[model samples]
Target: MSGNTKIDVSYVAELARLELAPEEKVKLQEDMEEILGYIELLEKLDVKDIVPTAHAAPLRNIWREDKAGTPPGKDIMLENAPGLIDDELIKVPQVLPGEGMS
Candidate 1:
């Protein structure tokens, strides 16, 4: 990586579906070049003896004993629902746009 690094800021912006002003393009190009330069520096590090790990520190799952909880009564459940059909079933938005109709 060098000061004369060339990056197609317009191409990158297009790929990201972003419209950048001329000044913004220049700023983004410089930022992207800096980031790539940093990555290049990282690639030069000696990691042969270093162990690859998902995290920097050891991780363990905390366990807790499962306990049965009382379910809400039908009346309370109905009251909390946004909408209900015939006061018996929960009404939700149709998933498919124009299917499942005669």
Candidate 2:
């Protein structure tokens, strides 16, 4: 991209659903040109021999068979609760008016 070429910042902003001021549009146009300039520089790089990779580092899924685990007993869980009712149920603050536990 040539520095002399113009970028339609207003059109780009409209596509992005942005309502940019005149000064903002001017700034955005300059910023966009700089970014495109960088892209142009990148296009000149030689990478024919380099292998394309999805990530910079190799990755693998550490998979294992899904298995059901035993749930903690009611008594064991109740012991950890800050507030309890009937020595079994965990008590929590009401989330909605007239909508607490029956």
Candidate 3:
């Protein structure tokens, strides 16, 4: 890893929308260099014939029996509701436009 191979800390800060202090910039630069070195080491590994496995152990379906079941009636379902205006509506927190919820 050459010292001349610059890691643009300012560009990183801008992308993350972070306001890094001058001292923090120096620390982050060192950390980024170390991370790049580790990635470079990983790039040199040989795994030509290795098949990718999703889990460490052998996996099984472990699924439950799928069958149709009766659902509770509307009155029983709505019994625990704090604020139900009618049979059709359930009152909830007042949501505002442009608040990221919509």
Candidate 4:
């Protein structure tokens, strides 16, 4: 498969809201072509009847029951907190509205 058939870097840059210089565009085009060539080579490999495996080593389901365990009281939970006001609220730097990134 041709690189042109696989990817259009200029179109991708436009979607990403990025501006690339002429040299950068050329470099990216070559890199994309090499990547597509590797993918085409992989497509030619035979893997019929192979059982899909998520990991190489012996695998087991690593999970615990979802039933609730012992719960910490509110006072115990907030005992080591850096900033707390009363039993329910955490004090943080007040951020002024409309003063941050869009």
Give TM per candidate: 0.39, 0.41, 0.40, 0.40
* CA deviation > 4 Å runs, candidate 4: 1-4, 11-22, 65-102
Mark the regions of model 3 whose C-alpha exceeds 4 Å error after superposition.
Answer: 1-5, 46-102
**In terms of TM-score, how similar is model 4 to the real structure?**
0.40
Best model number under TM-score: 2
lDDT of 2 by residue, 1-102 (tens): 455666789997889899999999888888988888777776567788988888877788897889888999878867878988788777788878896576
85 in model 1: Cα distance from truth in Å? 15
TM-score of 2: 0.41
Reference-based lDDT, each prediction: 0.82, 0.82, 0.81, 0.81
**Clashing residue pairs, backbone N/CA/C < 3 A, model 2:** none
Error of 4 at 64 (Å): 3.9
lDDT of 3 by residue, 35-57 (tens): 88666765566878989999989
Worst 10 residues of 3 by lDDT: 93-102
Candidate 1, residues 1-102, lDDT tens digits: the string is 454667798997899899889999888888988788777776567788887889877888898889888898888879988988889799888878987642
Best first by TM-score, ranked:
2, 4, 3, 1
Better of 2 and 4 by lDDT: 2
